[model samples]
Target: MASRTTSWAYRPSLDGLRMLAMYLIILFHTQVPWIQGSFIAVNLFFVLSGYLVTNVVLTEMERTGRLDLGRFYARRVRRLLPAALVAIVGISLVFLLVAPVVRRLGLVGDAQGSLLYVANWRFIAQANDYFAPNVDKSPFLHFWTLSIEEQFYVVFPLLILLLARSSRRGVMVAGLAVVTVASIGAQVYWATADPIHAYYGTDARLYQLSAGALMAVALRTWPVRLPRVGARAVAVGGMALFAVLCFSAVAMSQSNRGFLGTAACLMIVAGLMLDEDQPLAKALSLRPVVYLGQISYSTYLWHWPAILVMGMFLDVGPVTMAALAAVIATGLAAASAELLEQPVRSAKRLNRFRWRVSAVGVACSVLAAVLVVPTVLEREQPPAVASGTGGAAVGKLAAAHSDPLPKDVDWDRVDRDRGTEQTCQVDDLDRCVLHEGSGAHVLLVGDSHARMMTAMFEQLAKKHDFTLSTNIVSGCPWQENLRNTQSSPKRQERCDEARTGWYDTVLPRLDPDLVVVATLPRDHGKWHQRLENRDGSDLGLERSLLRATRDTLDKIEKVADRTLMVQSVATPRSFVPNDCLTSAKDPDDCVVPLTTTNRPSDAYYLAVAADVDAAYTVDLNPAFCPAGPLCSPVVDGMVVWRDNQHLTASFVAHQRAKVWRLIQQTGVLDALDGL
Candidate 1:
């Protein structure tokens, strides 16, 4: 194959690799049931980026005997910035308009994170679960990959220059190998220690980039002369392995990212070295495939938001959403490339001074962060509160007067739920303390269900003048070796690990005035289809809950004078915030009917509370569901449930006085005092 007129030859087959990587990523985002491991396409993109960037740097250095950072930075700016700026600004504006207020709040910070190329760390701090279906997912989540790539781009040039200047080819090779090996080690270690961090962390992903750079260095500094037969075998085998790694997977997991990265490295090395006339290389260089590859950056930028828009607002199925996302993303990317990207990159003035052009990218990013993101959150007057005189019943207040249905503004603040996340979302409960008080020391343990009652407990502790320390983990119970059906299998290994500090050591050490246990007694409110027994028993949900419950009872029986089993409040089947915000004029729209025809009884919890000695139960069912026929989510101008099952801190604060009276009536605290 003849080289192009530019310093480097135009490798259309490399573009084919880009097209395939993006295709897999888009498929993954659409939640294709069979494409669970397609996220590994990001590794391919990382590796490809490393190879191309290193090629550009080395080619310039070899020709001029010195690489110009200014020109390289400028070229990158003109090549990348225009399309990125347009996508971030345009996509954010659309999301602000269509998404609910609660969903839009994070865009302010995320927009800035995207522009500044630190979205990976931002996402890490937020503890985002990339695969979980239940949590609120940001459309900007995909930007984490871009952040990692950009970080490598900024640092790798200087590092590679130093390695090249070392004057020894062996040192350069060793330096690159060290980076690749160390980063892979980080990926393996973090994949086990904390999967979320492992996925998003820059340290864990450097190997993919370094592997590509190494391949580039090998080919650039020291050319490889391979026989045609040998090169053809590598091309065939590498592409085959790449396909298998992406297609042959069970769950959306990070465990196999290293293997995927290795495969990506193989794919690039094989493609780059193989003759263009080879069948695999010829197919990759097809006009349509190469065009798709050219527009892939913009396509990737638009596809995530497109899928999110389709899924959230359109009520479409995942497959249909995926198709629409692909179509819309492709169309937008084509337009962006034609109207926005090509003009800016090919402009004579931008070609002359890349730094000034690059500044425009920074300016556009700042504009998106400050202007576009804020527009998504409409300024709202705070919700009016009416704490009626002298502990008036919320039921009577709502019945006699109009109760304020939750506004979009209200749910936005409450839904963030930092207390719940900080306290219960950890794999370790030792450090997740909610409060430290001066009076009696009360120990709280369970999961998110327990954290929901935090506001009431906060009120209880403040009024009672006691210190409250909690050991809580979301989705997992206090009992060891149990995991819910919801978590990925790899993550399930750490399910009981959350209780490690508290279960065996903290409870025994604290031995507080009282030990309080609160959790969802039934899994998804169904005993038959709940948690699996990790000990490999087919004990299923009921027995799992039984063992978990018994474990809790035994721990509490030994640790405290008395125990209080806090029952979860009556759960509303109707989606909170969504239903309430939709029918804002009618307070009853979000009501949970407690009629025998609609309500489900807490039979298991009641039974468990009745049988255990030295244990008293506090069920806030009456407080929340005061009127037996219908339980209102909004009572006396306060939103009750933040989501379907969890109570808002504001509502809990409003109900705390009543909850205190209920606890006084239970005589559990008083009984402990007598002990």
Candidate 2:
């Protein structure tokens, strides 16, 4: 029952493993093909942290008869917090000076979260998709992994103390095993619907860390039972398979992440059990490789911010960026470890004053947060919903050709803010805000395309004395038994769930005078975008669109007095309009012809609208796009879109006066008048 009291040995090979994992992280961030899909590198980080911390705690207890938690925390703080805070403070300063406010929109909050070891949960709260293509990724995004490990450090020590009555090795192993199994189960359940949550959550990722914890308890003596051949085979083959997964689409998925975590654990075991003579072990033990591992902690901290900062100045390909970021981060990490990290880590005076070190850690975190206050205080234009009596100001604008880009505009708001309907995802289908104060009710439904219409609806609702609410999501639209093909299989499950939720749960809650369906229609998903019923077969693109539209309308008609469908605006062939206008000498240069290539076919959407009786449709494109070959992004002195497809909420608000006229022209509101 006695736990072994072996001295902790420095394993160069494990450090080598650390180096390799760090490389994978750098490569993934740099958008290396195939590698970007993998989560193995992140799993390996959790395993290493769990294994080493468990070893240190158990070793201390076995040798001293009691765990000194204060000392342990002081050590952890010195090891992690110093370099992390420096990176947070230093990188944030760079962002303040170099990056525009649009790029630095959420950096203040992100830096604070990163400092306090809560960035992981913060991301989960924000519904951040780690894999989503964000043009303005937070510099502190990498800090989420560090936060998870820090959480384990704080909790694991207390857990051991709770189990102090039983010091048996088997008991310790069993305790960790139970947690590992439960963590894996939690991951499976969460991964089914919200993979982003599953990916970043401490509870879901606990098993990966526990894998190493189990290894630490069961194999503390560093003894190898396997022969050279078996060790070589297991180590080489497991790593090879792991590498293959990292390079394949299969490895990119969060649900499949367990396999990668297991593979990492197997590799760690092989590294320990294999003798120094083994090829994997010997190669990993080399001084140069081990040096990278030695500086790996600081390197991980520096990598992402360095990439983003360097990206501002360097116009390079992915490979070049990856190489540049790696070199810069490694160099900086190496120097920081030598000059700053190691000095603080080994300071005998600081180690002696445990309470003081903890105090210093807390103070540093607060200081880092305070550093960004100036930027946060800077006044910027309000996002989404406007700030005045009329709403986001639709001031008289000059001609579209000569009007320069508005300096006062907040690009972050345009890109990020989607009003409060953001909460009413399919997962929470009944979450839409009901404006009970107003006598008449209006509903907006569809995808992000529909979300952009919020401001216009708000305007109409205010003027017409009606209440407006939206049931919209970015990639989800109202469809029966459907999925978004652009979305992953797991996302498809959520999409389908959302469809059922909105129709079966949300629709029946409140009767609305009118329902507006606005979506960018395209042929995608399971069952040809689920055009047919559950029992029916695929009906091609056109027939399928008709069937889907009919199904959606049928549901709306059940509760809504009238239904109004929208034909989405024209898509420009040029780059993101806001970005284009930023550099274009003339605002008109941002305009591009609505070519067949960039323009999506909404023929099915229009046909469905026309065919459905008692269901009116609106085409607001003519108000914005002139009857010509060119599609202007600037309309009525406001930038029409935040990006390629979604209209800016502010722009929509500004155009509300014109939009109301268009709605009046459609006679959809005339029916509202009759009501």
Top of the candidates by lDDT:
2
Evaluated at residue 422, the lDDT of candidate 1 is 33
Tens digits of per-residue lDDT for model 2 on 1-675? 212223467678889988988988898898776676455688877888888888788788889999998899989899899898888878866655554343344456777889889998887876655653323367888999999999999899998777666856677778888999899898988898777779889999889888888877777634446666666676787777777767746634656755565765567555455545577888888999999988999999999988876754454677899899899999989989999999998788786799778888878787767655445422232222211112111111212343456667766766775544443543453456534335577778777778777767776666667877777766776656444566666856656655765665667765667887777656433434433444355655544455667777788778887777776565652357778777766666665444321111243443344334456666676455552234565666666777776667766777677766767665566646432
C-alpha-based local distance difference test score of model 2:
0.68
lDDT per prediction? 0.67, 0.68
lDDT of 1 by residue, 1-675 (tens): 332112356688889988888878888888776775777788888888888898888788878988887778777777776787778778766765554333344456677788778999998877666764323357777889988988888888888788878777677778998999899889889998978789899999888888888877776656555666666666777766666666636443565755665765556455555556677778888999999999999999999988866653353566777788878998999999999889877788666676675676667767777776676543222112211122123334445333565344554676765245333333444455556667677877777777776767866777777877776666766555466767566545455555644455656666577877776645434545656665777754544555666566766777777677665565654445445545556554445544221111133333344435456667676676555435665678666667766767666767777777766656567745422
Tell me the lDDT of candidate 1: 0.67
Q: Which residue pairs in candidate 1 collide?
A: none
Lowest lDDT block of 10, candidate 1: 382-391
Q: How far does residue 66 in candidate 2 sit from its true spot (Å)? A: 2.0
Mark the regions of model 2 whose C-alpha exceeds 4 Å error after superposition: 1-7, 102-105, 221-224, 249-252, 370-675
lDDT of 1 at 368: 70
